[model samples]
Target: MDNEGRESGHLMLITPERVFYAGLLGRPHQRCSGAFHVYVAIKGGLRLAAEGAVEGYSELAVVPPNLRHTIASDYRSVICVLIEPETVCVGALDLLAKRLAGAERQFFVGRIHAACEQLQHEPRDGDIFSSAFDIMCFGDALPRRILDARVVKAIAQIGRFSGDPVTAASCAAEAGLSSSRFLHLFKQETGISFRSFRAWKRARHLLHFANQDLNLAHLAQHIGYPDSTHFSHSIRRFYGLKPRAIFSGSRDLAIYRSGRAAAGDSAWTQEAG
Candidate 1:
């Protein structure tokens, strides 16, 4: 993973629960949705301005899920932790926001910074990265599971068959519930509708094929989209960036843990920039 002369730098470690990104902020401004984002400045801080939200500059900042925002930096590097909203408790999110917005902004202090520094030295160390993230975000143990068991099963089914055209009724059947009950419970547990959750999962699945040199249409179809237009819209809606922009920015990315496959000796490979 040499990034000496690359236009943009990206090193990503993707686990089942979260994705860790340590990269240079190349795009002046970009929008991201779906996951809760924690941004830490490695060299110099970045300026973040969100729609109808307060603008601020700090070494660390937390963005809540589904909020539209733009980030800008003068070619500075950053470390971003993207946690799945369902994996975290709602109370913890409030606590994290207060901690980041506090006067001192001590969320990035102590072990968090140390762990991020360690990842900067070795981005492919998934175990260390996961441990550090657990300590930084969850403290002692993983966050308490707040989703209902049926909803959890439905989520797993969505991940397993993301490429297939899975409908709410199908998921409901898998969870042994009626369509209405499943939809209601799903929204109550996840804070998002089943349709929205499915779309997010489909969009997030694009990370797996980011490094491949495939056509946008092919990539779209591979991820269960009907065509390129639908694919483009879904990606832009969720990621706030076009499919090509995402692919180009990820050219030098090295993926660490892909859930489809086990982490092996050659799990880390740098795509040609």
Candidate 2:
């Protein structure tokens, strides 16, 4: 919310026939669980932001994680094409950055648009990700990015006990691996540490309690924060603003939202058009 006008729980849907997209790279109230590759093409746009706005939002850029996050859509033109969360691993993303090197605005779109179109036409059932992977295997064609079978088995063990007090040691044990090995596999597949990733996943559950009507302290406790101060600090340190800043008065943000709503699919600008 520092300026790109996005907040937690803002989703860009990607259906079988469509790639649901959001121009605003909503900063979060908490850390992010995972990272994925995105092939962006912009006619003219704002710099991506982690906090505070960026100037003269640019044409096209590839975003990598562990950097300050910023996504701004300028009044002139904005276009972004995003890959879904589970598609490609962080290593795959890093590999793409090393191999591709062109600054021209339009160079990226044709490649990505063609990939998306290829996925859109594939058969609709049972493991569409695999079909899509085969269609868009422009990178190293690694299975690590496709979420290993063992990793898939571990996902539920980590996710199921959310309401209970949990620690990485316990989570790692549940996955039947030594703590160090568990962490290495998790980071390789997900692009984040096990601790931060769990917290990132936890924030989604915390969202329901974040409504304006709720007391901030109460909301913090409800989301597993035993101390309200700790929660507030975490919110600020991670997303660059306290929780209260979101939904506070910001006319430009409001205008941006309304226009996004009205445009619907048309909200996807030329680069992604």
- Per TM-score, the best of the predicted structures is 1
Q: What overall lDDT goes with each candidate model?
A: 0.69, 0.44
The lDDT leader among the candidates is 1
Count of clashes, each model: 0, 10
Model 2, 48-115: lDDT tens per residue?
Answer: 44434343244445555434554444432233343334344445555555544344334445555455
Off by over 4 Å in 1: 1-9, 28-32, 103-113, 123-132, 136-142, 258-273
Task: Please write out the lDDT profile of model 1 over residues 1-273, one tens digit for every residue.
Answer: 446313244567677667777765556545767888888776667688877878877677788888888877644567777877776666776776676667646645444566555555655543433334566543543344455767766777777644568889988888778899889988988888998888888898888777667889977887788899999988887766788887777777766664432223212322211
Q: How much lDDT does candidate 1 score?
A: 0.69
Instruction: Give all TM-scores, in the order shown.
Output: 0.82, 0.52
lDDT, residue 209, candidate 2: 34
Give the per-residue Cα lDDT of candidate 2 at 125: 36
Worst 10 residues of 2 by lDDT: 254-263
